[model samples]
Target: MAHTITGRKRLLARVRRIQGQASALEKALTDGTECAALLQQIAAIRGATNGLMAEVLDGHLREHVGAEGLSAGERERELDQIAAVLRSYLK
Candidate 1:
């Protein structure tokens, strides 16, 4: 998780933005926001989440799957891990 630790501040900033967006969504709902506006908020949240996932997933792949000098077996295991995570995320 070294890559993540190095980028923790940036990632946390993204997470906080998502949190703020969700909070605004809730507030909008309570204030009777239009359907279009609500849908836009949801889309924004999804986009932000996807960006975060992409960033972390890239780091994970670099660290585990594509690290130099890794044995074939280790790379395979990392591939399996990524597959499982992708499966769960897709669901």
Candidate 2:
């Protein structure tokens, strides 16, 4: 919660940038932009979204999981599960 509060502005900025990207994507589609350009916009949005996910995941790991006194093996297993979920989600 403290991390979220402190990072609120930065996170909101990222979200607003993503929203702008979405708007641009919509405009491009409406204006019949070229396929290559449209694909590039989509890739940009995906990259930004992935970045945001990584930021949140990092904070979660540090503040929640990392603070816990889990054994090395347990931590590794937990992280592996998280990675699996992230992979499935991205797919």
Best by TM-score: 1
Cα-based TM-score, every candidate: 0.95, 0.78
Model 2, residue 39: displacement in angstroms?
Answer: 0.4
Model 2 residue 76 CA deviation (Å) reads 10
Across residues 1-91, which tens digit of lDDT does each residue of candidate 2 receive?
5667778899899989999999999999999999999999999999998888888778767875686788888888878977897889779
* Clash count of each predicted structure: 0, 0
* Candidate 1 per-residue lDDT over residues 1-91, each given as its tens digit: 8989999999999999999999999999999999999999999999999999999999988887889999999888989989999999989
Candidate 1 yields a Cα-based lDDT of: 0.95
Candidate 1 weakest ten by summed lDDT: 58-67
Q: Report the Cα lDDT for residue 58, model 2.
A: 83
Q: List the residue pairs that clash in candidate 2.
A: none
